[model samples]
Target: MARHSFQSAMATQAGNGHVLGYTVWNHFFRPETDELHPMGITQLNRLVRRSWREPLQLYVETAHDLRFDPGAPADYAKDRDELDARRMQAISTYLSVVANRNDVNLFVHDPPRAGMSSDEAWRGDKDMVHGAPRGYLTAEAIAKGAISSEAPGGFPITLQPDLGGAGMAFPQPPNFGGDIPVGDFGGDFGGEFDVPPGF
Candidate 1:
C-alpha cells in the first residue's frame, strides 16, 4: 500500500496557491519490498508516536539523499530546490513536535570544525544532521532512576538526575602496550643498530 498521500496533498495545496512544491526526493511515495519502511510522512508521524527511543536514533542515523538530474532545465531545477526546502521544513516541524511532546532537547548538530566545511560535515554522517536527546524515554529514565515523573507538571515532570551526564560516554582506547625495547634503551640492539663513527 502507498505510505502517504503526500503527492496528492501537495498537488491540492499547490492548486490552492500554497508555496509547497512536490518531488520524488521527498520519499513519501509507496515503496517496494527491501525498501525502508514508513516512507516520509508516515516516518515523521511514527517517530512522534513511538514509545521506544531507539527508533528515533535510527531515524536520525539513516541518510536522506537528495539528488537531481544534471541536465534538468533551469525552471525544473528551481522547482526541485524549492520542493527540497519544503520537505526539509516539514521534517523539522515533525522533530519539533516529538521533542516538545517528550520534553527532550532537540538541536541541529554542531557546525563543522577545523578542516571540515559545513557541507562536508552534513554529508559525512546522517546523524550529524540532528542532535540526539540525552536520556531515554520518560518511563525508561524513571526506571533507571534518571528522572521522576511525579513533579507538578506532566509527562517528563522531574529530573532525579541531571540530564548532562545521562548520555553514554564516547568509546575509550583499550589498555595495551608493546614490550619491545628501543635501541639505547634497556635491551641489546642485537648488533642491528651499528652506526658509523662520526669524526
Candidate 2:
C-alpha cells in the first residue's frame, strides 16, 4: 500500500510540470525486511525515467542519527546505529547507479558521535530526538550548503519561469492520443493525485 501510494503521487508530481525538486531523508527502511523500501529506489526511478529530460533536482540526505523509534529504549542505540550504516550503504548504491546525474545531489551528514566526547552531543529537548535543536540546525546547515554550491556540470536552479513580465507558462500536458485503459495500474494504489501523509 505504501509503495503504491508513493508511486501515484510521484507520477502526479512529475506530470504537474511545476515541481522542480525536493529533499528526502533516508528513513524509509523496513525493519522486518531489513531493506530500503521501494519508495525511494523503485518509485523514484519511475519518476526520474519519465522526466529524464526535465529539470528536476533531488537532494538525498544521509541517515540522520538523531531520529529514532520513540518506543525503543536506549539500549537499542547500537542496533540503530548499525541499521543507519546499512541504510547509508544502500542509499549510496542507488545514487551511484540509478539516480547518478547532475540533478541528483547527495549530502553526507556527520554521525551523532562525530565531534562529541560524551553523550552530551545527543542531548536536546525532552521528548525529542538526539541533538534536539542543535542537531537539526546542523542538518539545516548541510542542506543549505548543498543547495548553495553549484552542482557538477552546473544545472541552474530554476523553480519556475519569470512571471512578472508575462503570464506564467505552465507546461502543456503530454499528448497521449485517444487511447484509454480501464483496469488496475498493476499496483495497489489507483489514483494519481491522492495526497501523501505530508504535503
Candidate 3:
C-alpha cells in the first residue's frame, strides 16, 4: 500500500506538469508507528542506526543518482519567516503525503541543533542540518505557503507575495473567465458608474 501510494503521488505530481527529480525531499522519516507513543532521543537514535541507512543510500545514489543540495541554511533562514515555513511544509508534505510517511524523521535528524559538545565526531554530523533541496520546490516557495494572516471575520486574506517570486498580479474568481472588471467586476455591467466622484 505504501509503495502504491508513493507511485500514485508521483503520478499525480507528474500529471500536474511537474518533473519528479529526487533531491532534498527524496528521503522519508518514518515517525512513530504506535499510537499514543512516547517521544525521546532514543527513538531517533534507533531510527538513525536502523531505518535510515538503506533508504538514504538508495536516494543519494540510484539510476538517476540525484544528490541533496548542499547550501547554507543561513541563506534560507535570512529570508522572511513565511518563506521558511512554506519550504518546511512542502518538504514535510512531500515526505508525509507524497512519500506516504508520517513524521519527517529523516529531515529532523539535525545534529547541529542537537547541542552535543564540540567534538570531531559531532561536527562531522553537521551535514544533517543541511537538508537536501527538492528540485522544483525550494525552501523559498514552501515558506510562502506556510503562513496565513487570514483576515478576520471570514474574509480572505490577500496573498502578499514576498521578495522572490512574482506576487500574484491580482486575484480573481477561480473560473476568471468573462469580463470580470475591477470594483463592479463587470458583474453589474452596463450599469451606471455611480459614487459621485468619491463623494
Pick the TM-score winner.
2
- TM-score for each prediction? 0.23, 0.27, 0.18
Candidate 1, TM-score vs. the true structure?
A: 0.23
lDDT of 2 by residue, 84-130 (tens): 56665665667557677455533434322223444554453322321
Models sorted by TM-score, best on top:
2, 1, 3
What does the lDDT come to for candidate 2? 0.44
> Candidate 1 vs candidate 3: which has greater TM-score?
1
Clashes of 2: 0
Candidate 1 residues lying further than 4 Å off, grouped into runs, are 1-39, 48-72, 98-199
Q: Write the per-residue lDDT of candidate 1 for residues 54-109, one digit (tens) a residue.
A: 42331121113434456875655566455444444445555557554433232222
Clashes of each: 0, 0, 9
List the pairs of residues colliding in candidate 2: none
| Clash pairs (backbone) in predicted model 1 | none
The candidate 3 region of ten consecutive residues with least summed lDDT is: 57-66
lDDT value for model 1: 0.37
